[model samples]
Target: MKLLKIIIVLIGLITIISCKNEPKSLSDFKSNFYEIQHNGLRLGDSLNVYFFENEDLVKSVEIIWNGKLLKNHTIMDSTNTSLGINNLKIKVNLENNSISGETNVPILNSFKETLVEFEVVKEYPHPQELFTQGFFFHNNKIFESAGQYKKSKLVTYNLGSTNYLQEKKLDDRSFAEGAALLNGKIYQLTYRERDIFVYDEKTFELIETLKLPSILKEVWGITTNGKELIVADGTQNIYFFDEKFNLQRKIQIAGYASIYNQLNEMEFIQNKIYANVWQTNYVLIINPVSGAVEQYYDLASLSQTKGSDDVLNGIAAYGNNILVTGKNWNKIYELSVK
Candidate 1:
């Protein structure tokens, strides 16, 4: 009878051991186990994510925020996040079971951009027929890239010259967007074509066509700082590429309260990037490193001077003055914002 008792006790010990070693199952582990408590994940803000009552149950937490992996972080610092809907993925590794979920980040901030006023420096005659997609100053001429299905072209004219210096038209299928004169070569972007046309600066002869990265859905604006090319794709994101068209990095233009979108024509000057928010009369002066809008210039007065209600879409840096124009607009107004 004593041996039988010992055997029964041994069986009970085995049952307890098995139960203790077994992993706990959580049906809602991936669904409602965590919460993000911060100032709505704003730009330049850090995130604080925590599991409500399952902190002890969590063995480890891994996050993929904005397409970058972050270990031990529920969601990484938003200072490295994009402007609009940033992608987020979280995985919690428990003692035995592992679960993961993906969601979009809600990056809402409550701040306003500083409004900077402008005064008209001068006015220049711009071609009324040109659907200007890009505008910039190189040497003493204005290089413009116009966009349309069959009316796209690259044309150059002096700031005060009525006649164009050189004109090169694109084939019907290619809609030319932005152009920049870089290293004696003119790099022009084509909308929806995924192609960059390289040309000789003087002769405007087509040299070679480079393919754009697939990540950039549509190339809108193109510029250069004498070394790297800055590109925009309608969205708030701006991309930097080397002279060989290799992507170096990307930044999203963000204001204090909202993520600015429709970033069309771009020009880099005085170590700052000035971008035209498409269809709006706002020119955002952006900090290239932190992707913050330092100030914004309203072109509503200049926009109202247009013959038609075309969108203001062109910006060229001229020493201390900024030249602005729009599609099919008759006059280009040079402004002194300082």
Candidate 2:
């Protein structure tokens, strides 16, 4: 009750202060939460949401949307949220220990429609029978990064003749998730490992290991844009780094599908970034400028699921066609834009 009284006094103080001219940043004033949506959302679909209270104090924020609470890792206080097309108001509660404040949330709609479709032409000629996490093409050659508990390896193969080119085994049990050639070295990301394996590009020999940020260790995918190296982690955020491996600004992919699809294998093509959602047969083509997903390719038919085969694990651009493959699949297909 004492804290409530203090809050009531502060509210009164703010009300009086607002009538006079004042200088304040966003935190100094009550903020309104705007609803975000795009044209790609389906009816009954939900997405992740974050709330801020103060500087360096953004933790578990409870939100009441359409009179229901949510319970996801991203939103535990949420249970019943809106979906499809509808306008709703949300009450954002910021609990600062004993004192709290309420903010208003406004509803919005989708930005663009999502596209997902795929068809398996044939399997890759080689049949080693392993789960692939990353796939890249260079000069008609296919480079594959395999993932498993203890059977992980970085292998290269000739796509034209289906001949084994080379193989490099991991020293530790940690499986390699993604690999990219930057400058003349190969930088590799290890799943759940804070250590990054660097290799000589030409010889494919292990060079040295670099440690990632001390804060996070669950690295997932990696790619290069000629100048800087971009990476994705367990969280749906992408980080940029220079040749020295210094931490740069992070790009947050905020959307309904971005919350849990688990962005895997990343590939840079024609100034855009392409990533595949793990365990699903879909590839997301994103715009680096706005972090908006421009287009999506559905690879559901590649692996054979309920409606189609599920071969949408890896995505790469070879010349003018886009090649997509999946875990333990035989065929690597070349697809034209639809």
Candidate 3:
């Protein structure tokens, strides 16, 4: 009888000890959860995340990404996430503790071959002396940044009438390239001077001079999506920056058959980047995030109208229209993309 009683007591003690070690919920051991490794992943790339925890105490594991639950992830294995243009939020659900974190993984867009051509809606007289590098439209007016030492200037003109409205001559040594208008300021890039000149949008007066990143040897073009500025040099690389000129990201332009280099003069429209290839009559429409060329427009016939020395350079979006011009070109062509 005593032996039987002792056996019952031992079994009950074992059951109690097992129940005490088992976690009822994650909150009981939340402090023990720790992230081992988390990394930023690119679009189309696999995501590998790791964490350390007491596996026996964990009742269940759930992973959530971008508000959606990921069902097929191993506890310590890498999982492929879907492609997107924004940041990713990850939430880990444990029986006792739920932890969350974020990753700044940029999912590059897939490539699509879209063929398009341009039809001239209207042709306006452009200044033949202005070696146009960058162009933009603001408040129904055309703003331009022209290059060439001692000749570089930022000028504004009335769109249809082509009447000169304002002009600001840069310093003799400054050869201006691309121009972007944001807030109430005009940001102009210099060719070899390695300076970004800022001006008052309304008055066209020089406001400040900022230094370019040392990695960029030549500033070719610049445009903005209202919040951030996108700049390009002579290479295939394009850079994204905040309004304060802080580097945010970089993209390498990829063409269908080759890597498109010598990208000059850019325009951002409808989430796509249109860039003019230096010394070529081709304009490439690129996916900004993925660096893939979705389509290209050949303006060889348009170039025939200009002088032999003129090179296709500038692009701008004005209202519902896109405009194209070149260095020393006498006319600006309004384009219709099909």
Candidate 4:
């Protein structure tokens, strides 16, 4: 009876040990136990991932993006990822030689391309000496900001007569780039000085000077959606700023087949941003929210009639008309979108 009791106790100990040491079955393992930490993901950004499974249970992990193997670890980097929708799959190899079920993640940014052309409606005389950078129309008046090392100026004109109504010369150090008229203020940008000059709209008096974020080395174009301001550098990125000039967010502007660079003067029309490609006669109509080029308008014919020194750069919208001009061009052409 003592031997029998001893044997029974030994058997119970062995059962407990076997249960504790046995590997978890496939059904017990959960796939995608990891969590991805990000509020939102954009193109040219890196995604950091975290896993919840025990390291001892995981032999290896594989991450796939858009049907391509991205990494073999928990953290996946999307630095060179392309724009648009992408599929992601995560697979984990268990220590017991079993694989977990694949986890599917959908990363998406809807971007599409559209083609557009324009018809000339009318032409208005523009000063040939003006190195036009920013152009806009408000209250029956046309406001233009011209740039050159020592010749940068903010000038206003009567829309009908094209006669100068007011003019203010910028300091020799300020190479003015773009301007936006909002409320009772006019905001102007400089090329590399990082200076944003604010002026009283009615009096043209200097109101204040604001500095841009250090990351924005060059300020090329600016526009407004009534409240917030949208700014562009020479690259594919566009920035949004609040009423107080605080950086809100940024997006990479993508075209049909490639990313649009050298984005210059900009104008806001019906929620879309119209920007001129520097040194090109092509205008990109961009959807600001998605950073997609909705349409491309070729204005190459307009430049052919101008002097060799003229380079397409300015755009503006007023009432029911869209106007386009260039640096030192003789005329501003009103466009009829077709």
Candidate 5:
């Protein structure tokens, strides 16, 4: 009995010692031991990682990127980046503890965009009161979503007719911004309401409404690649979401020199995203996979209206061409881009 009691005491002492010596998790650290200098970095830019003066506490340092240990790491140029959010971790080993710091390596476009020329092929009649926010073609018909408090609506009409075949007005508080038809449903975006109204494409009846994530400042443009939903928020960022409005991924749109902001009224065509730059006559053709603006077109001369609010803001696939119009404009110009 004495021997068993002695063994129990020894085990208790050993357990106490081990518990005291165990290292804490990285979250328990009170201060950051290292930093990557710039948390947001562009592709082809040099990166610098700085470690604080804590040689006494840190025995060794290991930098891991995307789950693999990096050896002799320096710059994170285009050769090593894939052009999205990248995970980076720095592990520091100490005498009695080890911890890791995590950060995101956002990659931006490194190449300049090429100017593309386009000419208007035809002009179609549009409602002068329609504040066009979203424009697209479906089954030889033109579908549009107009924005304004108490006036937001979704309508479908013929190509050359000013009469609406089907129309559905939103709630007085909802300001519809963008709309896209996917999988027999029409998904409409609200600017500040942060809600997506899903409707049956044929009946135009409300099926359900999905809430946008709080991380998004405001919903702007939206499109679908027949699979996932892609959205913009009037910023340099574009987000990809599943049918339920859950975000799958996000990318920062980058032009030649800087990040492009005010991205509104997007259209996905031929594996590329054509986005309208808000308040400007510029439309950027971006590679959806790389977030790179490969080309841009200027359509300043298409609009006859000179009002400051009549900025070019809509784009739609018109067979082999594209149809564009501005907010509250009376004409929809079809363009053929080379």
Candidate 6:
């Protein structure tokens, strides 16, 4: 009887070991990488993701709320979104595509008090040189997308020269707004082109144009959040697309329980998205999961004129400092990190 019992115990141990599952790679599903603005997954909403691990196309996902995940869904942008507590739990499975981890981060009411003050210590040297709407400093190069509704252009501003290092004029009919470089190529969005244009980064050559979805009401600003590409419209909505540029998800920006303003020209920092609330002098830092405005930095004091662009438009980050410009301004000012 003792020997029989020993054999049974060994069998049980084997069964339990066989049932052990592969470890989960949830590091990617941790926090919000973009500011929670209209058009991202939020509370009561979820996103499905497919990725490869150990040479297998494993399925994993993230559930976001208020622009951040208090439990498992992650924001991979280099932004700082942390739970700071070990009380979080996540459920994972190897073969199950529906198994998910979800959570709601308690909206810290403190954001209303976390006063982030910006003194705009400096503005771009020539703030009214051109009607620049979008600005990005990529690989030590400055690419500015200009907008004039009927006279927009995509120009690479020469750091110290008045001449456009390399530029492309869009038929004087398409209004270009924000743009991004992906896989050695540049993608440009126009105000009313009803399409997005692609360019060869080195040649500044127009490669192709992608027609927006018929339902796409407008295209304003755009940037990549590492795993996906994000774009904004004149309204409060933002769109998410896969690597193939396929529409995957969307969210809207609202305030006081109502969609407040048009979200314009975007810059993704850390894991949060910083955007200009069209024609406003404030840069709103948003939480992507809860659609919550975690922080707002007043930039009305950033410029000498409030005199240049409409209010505020272009936003670009370099190291710890941020650079901002406007739609029809000539100079792009580099900002001091506050």
Candidate 1 TM-score versus the reference: 0.81
lDDT value, residue 210 of candidate 6: 83
Query: Across residues 15-40, which tens digit of lDDT does each residue of candidate 5 receive?
Result: 78865755455443433423442444
- The lDDT-based order of candidates, best leading, equals 5, 1, 4, 3, 2, 6
User: What's the residue-level lDDT of 332 in candidate 2?
Assistant: 71
Can you give the lDDT of residue 326 in candidate 1? 89
Which regions of candidate 6 are displaced past 4 Å? 1-113, 119-123, 127-129, 255-258, 304-309
- Clashing pairs in model 3, backbone N/Cα/C closer than 3 A: 25-95, 25-96, 26-95, 26-96, 26-97, 27-96, 43-107, 43-108
lDDT of 3 at 283: 88
TM-score of each: 0.81, 0.65, 0.67, 0.70, 0.76, 0.63
Rank the models by TM-score, top first: 1, 5, 4, 3, 2, 6
What are the per-residue Cα lDDT tens digits for candidate 6 across 16-84? Answer: 664454434444333232222233332333323323333242344444433445444343222423211
Per-residue CA lDDT of model 1 for 1-338, tens digit only, reads 99999999999998788556543433343334234422455654555445545566677777777677764434334446655567767777876567677766646433566888778878989898889998998889999999898999999999876589999999999999999988899999999888899999999999999998887988988888778999999887889999778899987777766778889888998999999988788899988876778889988877843444368989999988889898888888989876
What is the Cα-based lDDT of residue 136 in candidate 6? 77
Cα deviation at 33, candidate 6, in Å, is 36
User: After superposition, which runs of candidate 1 have C-alpha atoms over 4 Å from their true positions?
Assistant: 1-39, 52-87, 106-112, 304-309
Q: lDDT (CA) for every model shown?
A: 0.80, 0.62, 0.75, 0.76, 0.82, 0.62
Where model 4 places Cα greater than 4 Å from the true spot, the runs are 1-58, 62-112, 160-162, 304-309
Query: Residue by residue across 91-157, what tens digits does model 3's lDDT show?
Result: 5554445555554433433454566866788998888888888998889898999888999998999
Residue 63, candidate 5: Cα error in Å is: 5.8
Top candidate on lDDT is 5
* lDDT, model 3: 0.75
lDDT of candidate 4 over 1-338, digit per residue (tens)? 99999999999998777556544533344333333322344444455443434555667767676567765342333453544334565566664454433433323333446657678999888887889988998887889999998999999997656568999999899899999988889999999888999999998999999998886888999999888888998987888897568998876677545667789899999889899888888898888776778888888788843554468988889667699899988788898876
Q: Candidate 6 at 194: error in angstroms? A: 0.7
**Per-residue lDDT of 97 in model 3:** 52
Error of 1 at 283 (Å): 0.8
Maximum-TM-score candidate: 1
lDDT of 5 at 305: 51
